[model samples]
Target chain A: MTTPSNKLPARAIIREVGLRDGLQSIATILSTAHKHTWIRAAYAAGQREIEVGSFVPARLLPQLADTAELVAYARTFPDLFVSVLVPNLRGAEDAIAANADLMIVPLSASHAHSLANLRKTPEDVVAEVARIRAARDAAGSRILIEGGVGTAFGCTLQGQVEKREVLRLMQALLDAGADRVSMADTVGYADPAMVRDLFEDALRIAGDRFWCGHFHDTRGLGLANVYAALEVGVTRFDACLAGIGGCPHAPGASGNVATEDLAYMLGSMGIQTGIDVQQLLALRAQAAQWLAGETLHGSLWQAGLPKTFTAAAAVAA
Target chain B: MTTPSNKLPARAIIREVGLRDGLQSIATILSTAHKHTWIRAAYAAGQREIEVGSFVPARLLPQLADTAELVAYARTFPDLFVSVLVPNLRGAEDAIAANADLMIVPLSASHAHSLANLRKTPEDVVAEVARIRAARDAAGSRILIEGGVGTAFGCTLQGQVEKREVLRLMQALLDAGADRVSMADTVGYADPAMVRDLFEDALRIAGDRFWCGHFHDTRGLGLANVYAALEVGVTRFDACLAGIGGCPHAPGASGNVATEDLAYMLGSMGIQTGIDVQQLLALRAQAAQWLAGETLHGSLWQAGLPKTFTAAAAVAA
Candidate 1:
């Protein structure tokens, strides 16, 4: 956790979203039993936080239908911050019952993306969050609520998402009683300069309430954009283990920045994340075996650690 | 070229090194005729600087055997800054005879790498630079002599190259009569933090005399490393057109950052590179077709530009 004083965040957290984001787009369907193994292995690999799956109906997304079960399983780990993606209040209720550490409700900033993907306007999603918050309070749930603003940079359905609009939605979500807000480059339209400019303004608006920076490696700027976000003090990121989550909108587009690659970059910069990169790579290999023929992406798996890096330091317990 | 204020360099240059760095590594034997076409198309695609070939012995590197001829062909373009790599005094003589715009002599900073790769110690290479400079002066050649320090970050054979050692070599090159100097992450053992910290000190020492930043994309930190150098106002970078180069020491390691992706990043950041990314992509396709079995690394060609990006701006005439 030895982040240079005030120059960069002392510690950063990489939340694994492979089960939710990675599986949602790919054709792979790991058994629920395998999902539990992933959770346990990830926790043992020094990953304290993981988005096991999304609380969506089996009919909608068969891949993450067992999210509640996965959340319950992940909860057994002492320090693991178990998280689930809940589309609406019904899913949030399930999350609360599972006693998850956090539930992320996603809202698209682009109206066109919102309508096309979520079948609702941006404001509608915001309003749904306010309702979800009320329900959580009524149920006396201690679970944290994170309002994730998707397509914060731009959208495939709608180009040029206005910065003011993204900021407005972010402020509205925080005012609606959410525990924290995060920004996602859902369609991978972000560049480093764009990330720095937007995240600067985002931190100014949300301050400590800004939870995470989620980036896709669609155009290969994923790690570069993450670096830019780090420049402005972002200490949390959402990534997949093998960078397997492709954007369904942009065919052949890549997925989230690979967790192994992200972890290597963070650890190399002397930023502590508590997750062992070596363990992450092993998990990636295990995940790769479970879902054969899937297009897994990442650079470190091929190149391994840099010669200057001490393998022991990145080795997970 | 509209450069930003002193905070960010308004104009940036993507010096094409695909021929020298890219072709030298791959097994593809592009004919002298194909090399001419590449140089012409690259120039027509708004590339103002190009490293045509290396002035090495024909038996050692048959691919770049036609270095002098390629330099002559590239020099036909009005605005093109034709350059070549000179391995020793003999190579320097060939570069001077070809009337190149610039000649780069590479020196490996890691002692083991220096002896293995170049058959010379760091000091030996520095002394050679002085001899090469004397020859260039005696030959009355205006061709700029650039002493390129490779493995400036770390090396595959010898790890943990000290920062002080890299700086000393760079200073020695300048004192030995080299016209300008550049630093290269030859093994891709660099992170953005390392790039920023080292490049900041390097810039402080060399100022604008620092000719270029050359990075390998081996560990996927190439563009991120480029961004870090850009933060310190580095305006020149060396890149392979399709990322066709791979380090020989590290098996499966990637080459210099791809020209097309680097161009896209710079253009999107509002840093002018005078490169049309679409045109670069077309050239990459042409190059790819020629080198069928080779693995070309880059992201933009696969995902394409985001809908928000104006592709027309990236299309060269």
Candidate 2:
């Protein structure tokens, strides 16, 4: 039997996405001042990478209308790599104007979902990536462009998305000039075996350009899927504080893997995440209070860190 | 890097412990009729092994006082391997009287937890297993004895449990006449790496005699820990329906990994669990109703099965 002990990487990155992916789905619109404080707390707690907000039109996602402001505030701290999600070239231009460190262009691999969610086909999104890449080069923007393939595992609308199609789109995005690529279990349809299989191939195709894994805890396999990705050597992950995101179609479903829970899992496994779990938990408590009426999900808040956990074992974030 | 692709077993056993471990910890006392129906549903849904209940004093766990009756009822179904938790020789005698297929004697590896929870040291419990084996032999019963090592990961009262001590006690239990042995993360302190490390050692020590893995979702690593155990070639696991159990010290902590979620994970991976997930969901809904007012946990019930799931791929129970 192959042991996964040697397969796991010593260090991993968790890009906080609560300010973007999380806030857009929920009803409660957090104020910019409150978001600034949240970002400050997150930065203080040892988070180095954060998806500050999305660059969608304010009328579309007013919750993240302050994406430029958040990116600016987050950039005040050195080494805090900031990212913003953009749907089309227009949103990409807004991100470029904001001088964001990176911009993620979401392309749904599922044909139906792509048209429904983004009002375009997968190929259309790929074409837009080429345009966005040209625009970035013309503007001399140093910001990285990431093609995030949503519903890469499976989709609620499309049911089953073929892995080949997902891979093809990823390759197309790379060919269209995306700086990096990643896969997301948009509706939590991914199981560990699927994650391992798809990601193994993804690693072979994209290699170091495979930026991150985004999983929704909608069906409770989020962390398990993360562990699977880790075994396959995909180190970077996207997490939301308090597990704040969810599918609007599936009520009572959870969002991304909870930041604190994921942090604890990595720390316990001796994987250097550089995020202080206690501080992250403190931030989770505050976020929970901020989004009180909205149902929050996670396990570590109630059962704090185990007594066996030693802060000395962890490296400074 | 060694790939975990081939390490996972194609089929695994999930021993339903909700009726025993789950019901005992909660305040609700389910009627014997309800439990009988629950067993019937579980049997129909494809569960072959079940820990009927504990053979403890009625006043202590009036919730499980109908254990003998449950065992008897469960035995009526041919091929249903019914097991019971026995604390001492007296409980073993009762289990023998009930004609149980197996009797598990729990031995906490943590000294403080052993004393506090069972009022016996680990050695004392090992000695009792020997006595229980002797009594079974004297009674001319063919019941299999399993020694379940709880807090094998770490403990709440005592900080860290040494791996050497845990393995030593496991060998001790076998030396004392246990037919099988298993380990449990009693307080949910284990991560996948720790699970893989310890379980690999356990498989080497016990070989085919290694019984099962029991994990609590207290900190949400239960399923991930299960995946790790699977990678180490441990096939059997303990789970509760709706995740009905918890650490009493932790107010809002979840109990065991939900049976349906575990089944889904195994099934999605091309593992043949024999149980129909749809039927299991039906049983979960009914059990949730029977144990109303209790905080239930699990993800599949809220979000129905992924469209990619195919029943033809599964073996019949």
Candidate 3:
């Protein structure tokens, strides 16, 4: 019942997924000016890591077609760690060419989802990671390679993914030459207990090589699951501002956990996530207007700040 | 981490505050049939505890004027623990006469809030609890008394509430013959760390006499705070369905954590909260139509259940 006197110094990293995850699902396409403004504002708000864009085909996701320009703009911020999602080796090459800090190659753990969405099996995607890694080494690039296992918990197309299979794929990715690996509850099926168990086991096998936890608040367990992951020592998390992404297949899958809400949760727990909640909420307000018809999700923006929060002091600085 | 093999027995109780807290805040007044249906559905959904109504003057809270009739109806359910809010001695009489399982008398720790809203100091309120206790004894009533310390975290009129004062008031209520006491984030200013520290202190003073944790997701930390309190062993919680209440004085203060979302969180964590989340969502659907113009808050309703939920077995049952 006692407060931990020297609460462990929270080194939590909140990766801004607004540009990629937030934009892709929403119908509205922000002009390049608004996109750059959002990136700059997020950086100014003390966000050190941001998922600026995805290297998907422009025709499939027209909202994020300006990603290349956005990635180039993000690189100008010295302190910011810019990352992007790459669907294949081609996307990885573009990322390396752009000198992105990190490139995530997503491989859906569910075979059905992998086939339906990516048109590749999980192993095929793992092989691509190897190819991407070899290409990076040949090109003498220092950009980090992340093998992100999406739908690691369950998939809408094929339900109930075995934990053993998920672990095997995670290890297989590392064996196939991925520099780092992360797990995602792409469909928000993970509970806190499941998160703690899977994450602990993943860390035991991968050690420090296991990098981030991506959760969708589609069922409102996102922050709770994050807390469980934190207990097991996972620090970095991927979150979309205003919780902006939804699964196209899953009828009503809402966005990922809202970035500002996550920041607030972490900051209030004495966790040192380097993002200003107030600024994030302000960013949400501007983004909301730009996304008028689309549904936005978050609690902090509507409730405002608690009186105890000294966020105004942080924002003023 | 290993799913705790023997799941934590269903220890938590979600006191349905939708009727009293939800309806009172919104402009809509549901028909008595809908209210009875809500109560019946909630009980059928395994909700053993509910705050059916607030015993306030009809002029003040017209929406809850049928509280007496509702309580009379709720009494028919043998296992259902129906409770009501009693703002003063007059409200307490009505509550005691109705033979409620429990009666909660709210005492605001903030002096400004107490005077502005209740027109009584916190000490005076504690004296009232003593009087109510005497009245119950005189009337040979078996109803339990709960002194709800509202605005315990902070207040809009009076900002930083001292932990010492809150603890003292909590102790005072117990000394004044209140059977149990609960802490509330009336202004939604409490963070998880604060929640842990305060609940720990309160538990130390009251022992098991400290009963429930009530939190407003005002700044999005309600569930986080609830988790912190759980870490310290507080089990029962107060949540409005769809997160439906707010402070009239505080411009954007929202309700407590959405009941359905909280149920999803605890149930997902493998903690048996005895709430049927899907049924809760169904109730939310009806409640939403009843509250078309008002704002509704929750994440799980929009996003259907996660694909991996085997709890569908229990929820379906």
The sequence of per-residue lDDT tens digits that candidate 2 reaches over residues A150-267 is 9999888878999999999999999999999999998888988899999999999999999999999888899999999999899999999999886554344458899999999998
What would the per-residue lDDT of candidate 1 be over residues A15-41, giving only the tens digit for each residue? 999989999998878899888888888
Which window of ten consecutive residues has the lowest lDDT sum in model 1 chain A? Answer: A1-10
Sorted into a CAPRI-style docking class, model 3 comes out as acceptable
TM-score of 2: 0.98
The prediction achieving the highest lDDT against the true structure is: 2
- lDDT sort, best first: 2, 1, 3
lDDT of each: 0.86, 0.90, 0.83
Chain B TM-score against the true chain B, each candidate:
0.95, 0.97, 0.94
| Alpha-carbon RMSD of each model | 3.4, 1.4, 2.9
Q: Using TM-score, give the best candidate's number.
A: 2
lDDT of 1 at B94: 93
| TM-score list, all predictions | 0.96, 0.98, 0.94
DockQ (Cα-based) for each candidate: 0.47, 0.66, 0.48
Candidate 2: stretches off by over 4 Å: A1-5, A249-253, B1-4, B247-254
Which segments of candidate 3 are over 4 A away from where they belong? A1-8, A312-317, B1-9, B312-317
When summed lDDT is taken over every stretch of 10 residues in candidate 2 chain A, the lowest stretch is A246-255
Judge the docking of candidate 2 as incorrect, acceptable, medium or high.
medium
Q: CA shift at B294, candidate 3, in angstroms?
A: 2.7
lDDT tens string, model 2, B101-159?
99999999999888888999999999999999999999999999999999989998887
Report the C-alpha displacement of residue B91, candidate 2, in angstroms.
0.4
Error of 1 at A50 (Å): 0.3
Tens-digit lDDT track of model 1 for B5-80:
2255677899999999999998889999989989988987899999999999889989999998888888888979
